[model samples]
Target: MGLVGRVREGTRPPESLLLTAPGERAYVDRWDCDVAAGIGLAHLIEAFFTSKAFRAERLALAAIGRGGTDGEALLLAMGAAQNFAAWTQVERRENEILLEDFAGRTRCWLAVTPSADFTTLSFGTAIMARHGMHAAARSENLAFRALVPFHRPYARALLMSAAHKAVRLRQRAVSGG
Candidate 1:
């Protein structure tokens, strides 16, 4: 499989995926690191809301719809998270998801964030809120692991429970947890 395909299959993006196809595919999968990151987001979301896996997949797909990442020259690379959220709603029919020009709009949305440190945690939260959803407290646990550098052990344990709950929810959904 191609590097992009492998990345979707849970492998990290290898250097080979970054080759420029030029006249061949117009864009090479390797040139867009966000695609890998997008996969991560999808996996993360799936880990949280098993019943909502389809929505999470739709969110990930929406996030990448605009040329994988570099489709828009003006937006920051991180803004793709917003696109993912936006597309989820569009796909869910929770809102009217229309693009005047699909390619152009995707390009514009992809170019919306320019900062290297833009985390879509807030954006994803907002989308979750709109869907009347919240991260299982278990995320706070993962956040604890993620925030060990910040030294918030108590908070980490709390969030870890949420993460654990989320995992159980998925397990139950899959195997009756």
Candidate 2:
């Protein structure tokens, strides 16, 4: 079983919209915005993965690794694409989608939930950091900790960007455009 699979087997909320304890430090950040009525869980996931905002974020991270020795390499090693399939699908319901990915000393969970009115979408992420195996790993965790404060707004913008895309796609689908 993968890291995510193991997490799924543990004692945690099956459909938790945030990350839980069991690590050295943890953070749970969420962003909520209005979405179209036709937007579903699947649509949200697809939109998020394919959105320009996501691509931009990935590029920015890659840029951070452009020049440097160990630090650059470590930052560059963080691949946005790897997380998509690496995350184990913990829950999938009519209005919610939950996925968890645990790689190295970091365990993260992402949840997307649509409000009862189908007009509000909430995107949440829970990240747990642990001790690493080597100096590079330790440095990486330290960097992550240092950047935590900036994460909330970045996460919110990313989710909102995807939500907008999902709404557009839904409108297109409904209008046969």
Candidate 3:
């Protein structure tokens, strides 16, 4: 009655609902959105991809309640941790966690302290780029930008596999593919 799909409404009520206690059905109803959201992601992914890594990362993040910004952060984190920063660490200052990356050789330091979840990753990625590793720095950016929006049923699976493959393929192509 409130808003159709926004609130589950139907003409015929369940016969068992009359027998069950008020709190008993609450658990089931609570999970309804989760189950539906899960199925939606799967359906969307399958209908969208030609590969797997793209699917996996997207699904993993979605399952964890993360989206585009998180996706971007993830890419940046990977680049910074693996390529740009020779060392990365978190520091507590007042009430915040500051993520710091050091370029090691040049003694250049890049720091981004996010008050929110994915900011550290994005910050780290910027650090990596600032240090001059363009390839590693931009991989996640490319994935998030080019491949992460399929929204098909097999989305997660296809995204993971496809992302891995795409990276490899891109590497090969760049090296002379």
Question: Which numbered prediction scores highest in TM-score against the true structure?
Answer: 2
> Per-residue lDDT for 116-162 in model 3, tens only?
22111000011111223588645644553443233222323333343
Put down candidate 1 lDDT per residue, 26-118, tens digits, no spaces: 111110112112122222233322223233434565576622222221121222333332232122111111111232221101111123532
Cα error, residue 60 of model 2, in Å, equals 6.5
* lDDT scores of the candidates, listed in order: 0.25, 0.53, 0.27
lDDT at residue 39 of model 2 (Cα atoms): 68
Error at 18, model 1, angstroms: 21
Candidate 2 vs. truth: CA RMSD? Answer: 10.8
**Which of the two, 2 or 3, has more lDDT?**
2
| C-alpha lDDT (0 to 100) for residue 17 of candidate 3 | 24
Error of 1 at 169 (Å): 2.3
lDDT of predicted model 1 = 0.25
